[model samples]
Target: MIQEIKPAIWQILGKQPGRNVVIIGGTHGNERTGVEVVSKLKSMIESGRLNIIRGTLVLIHGNPRAIEINERGSEPHADLNRSYLVDLLEREPTGIYEDQRAREIAPLLIVSDVVVDLHATNKPSEPFIACADSSGHEQVYQWFPSKKVLSDPNYVLAGKLVTTDEFVDAHGGTGLCYETGQAGDVTRVDEVMRNVINLLIDQNLVEGEVRIPSNECEIYEMIEPIVLTAVGFTFAEGFGNGSWEPFVADQTIGYHGDVPLVATYDGVVVFPKIQELRKEGSPLAYLAKKVNERKKPPRD
Candidate 1:
């Protein structure tokens, strides 16, 4: 039976006392790839095919109700991801569905040494990893090499949960968000899940073959976000995933009749969800760079 929480489901695997690796999937209900990946991993571990080397593996379905309905958020359409870092029970006295789940999972998240929040984008693109903390980015890269790593401080702040970030900061552990691909990409889903399992093994948290590459590609970071506004006459035709070309500063990206929506910053266009019917404040793309000391200063 699916272990049920208020608006989520969770399964604990290999409950040994060693390293802790927590895998969260379906944070955005519509992103089915993560849900499938987490389910598969849970099944593998339960069947005795996958074993934990030293520590434990925690698999969580972040938004079960949303996943069931195949929508972005829970029944009331509240994003469960944004619900973290706050006292949900007190804030929403009526008890929002996602808020309840957040309260229940917060403790588990706080105790975890490593966290991998799996998600799928609305647009079709190559798999990429998003990390807020520089140290966390490095640790994740060492485990599972990504095609690109967006590591802008502002982007990190914009995409991070304050409570979750605090937990990682306190533990000096890594927390990463993996965007496998657009929802329903089974091939990429399997690939990312396998890589994540291997990472758990390599970190000595699980009992399995450690797959490491002799030479790994460098990870790229985002310097700035390509912000889209509601006032702009940006008519996105078709699904704009990674199809948009590199944009130089002051170049015209789209037109509001005769007015041009010029590029405010110089960076490659990434994750442009043209078909997305979400709000205008949503991120269009970002310019990234490598996570290094030069980019991130030492914290006191």
Candidate 2:
């Protein structure tokens, strides 16, 4: 059963001894993939269809109020994912929903040995993993079984944004942000559940053999985010998420009315969300350059 320690936060503990792992979903209320997966897992466990042989597993719904309204955030221009700023971990009242929620959720990271922060893009795309510079700890992504692991990009980590995955990592735990798929896609729930189950098995939290994917995982580096800061920003071509086409310098991918938002360097346009209306300072898309074909390396 799911117990509510606080509003919007829920945890479930397994029967046996193991590491403490936490997985979060619904950081953006509109992203239903994580939330659905958590709920489904809860049912599966209760019905004896799945078992957690060891370790405690915590599943959290990051933005319950927003999910209640079926919007990205409950209020206009609100973002819950970026609310984990370091200074705000004090748990003091922040006067903002996302900020206050972040404070309430901070304690979970303290006990987490592994953290999986799940997310879904506004535009449809293939699943991927967003990890920090894990040069020394490169084996983390092998568990999640994603072909593409994205690292730093253009203007990556440029602002004061502190994500949930980063916070859990700060506590000396393994943290990863998994982008399941597009928000409204029906298959994202299964994708999120499958990858998370693989993580659990690889970590020995569950008693099962891991199913390795046939395709090799690849790594990419995000170089730039096409920011839609102006009122009239619109895509030149309606690009879906994960649309990686060759882009040249000064090529107009979109426009702020008549003003072209051109690429400054050569790369592929990725995670483009051209179908929705976005607030200023939000990303219209990101450009990524392929770093390499990810390979298993000798352990240090």
Candidate 3:
């Protein structure tokens, strides 16, 4: 049976022609910054506080049921971000809450020209953008405020886990997701909204002056996703998500069944989580290396 159904799609037209951009927030229930900022953007448009100078702007509340409950997904382990694959949409509508929702959005993703799905981390960490270099366009990273961008080749190699951006790209649209600060951070809402506004101005979807930053941005290429199956697994204390400490090859970070898992190269950690029992294939964390040519060549 279909659960919570919230009609949160909003489309506004501009006076002239431009790119069809879709911004999605709250793909994960616990990430309220998207919902809060999207709603605020909608109000600004309705109140004549902002104008779409060109093309069309579409706003979507990605996972309303999950957001309503203030949980990561509608149910345990059912992440909406990882449920946008084409196979799941076509053959697994009844699979789970996330699958069902994916079916509802698969078509919409194709029609939009540019898509930005907003999300926030579970714990307090720095903000960043996660995109695939294969997703198309170098400027996609510039549209956000985060100075750090992650291009995970393994995520593409894993194949099964297709994010909203990848799914959108398969359908011929450019898509990317922005990871804001912690989900519960009070400043998250404003920061996200400001970034969205900047994107609008930068993309020329709205009319305004935007100060594109001259500050340097860094690119991190995800080398591997650390799979956690051991009931008892953890990293060294103080080593956590959003960490960018370099380690010599073979330095121990954690262990599995008495087997020490060491760094394969000089790398940094991302998305460190401590779970008593992690489902198989669950990425406990990711190891990445800073890259200079993030705009050129697919990650190896």
lDDT of 1 by residue, 1-300 (tens): 224433344545444667777788887788887888888887877687777757666788877778888877776437776666534434644478777767777666767778888876666766667665454455555555454665445534346544343344445556777777776676776677777877787768766676455424434555655456766545333313462245667767665454666655654555555444344665555545444323332342
Global lDDT of model 3: 0.73
TM-score of each: 0.78, 0.85, 0.87
lDDT of 2 by residue, 1-300 (tens): 557778756666667778888888888888888888877877777687777778887878888898899787769767777777665665567698888778878778767888888887776667778866464335456655466777663336435537787766667776778887787665767766877788788777778897655546566778877777665666667443355656778888777778877767776777666444454787766778777774653443
lDDT of each: 0.63, 0.72, 0.73
Evaluated at residue 142, the lDDT of candidate 3 is 68
lDDT of 3 at 137: 39
Candidate 3 off by > 4 Å: 1-6, 87-89, 134-136, 156-161, 241-245, 274-277, 293-300
Over all chains combined, what TM-score does candidate 3 have? 0.87
Q: Model 2 scores what on Cα lDDT?
A: 0.72
C-alpha RMSD by candidate, in order? 4.3, 3.0, 4.1
- Tell me which of candidates 1 and 3 scores higher on TM-score: 3
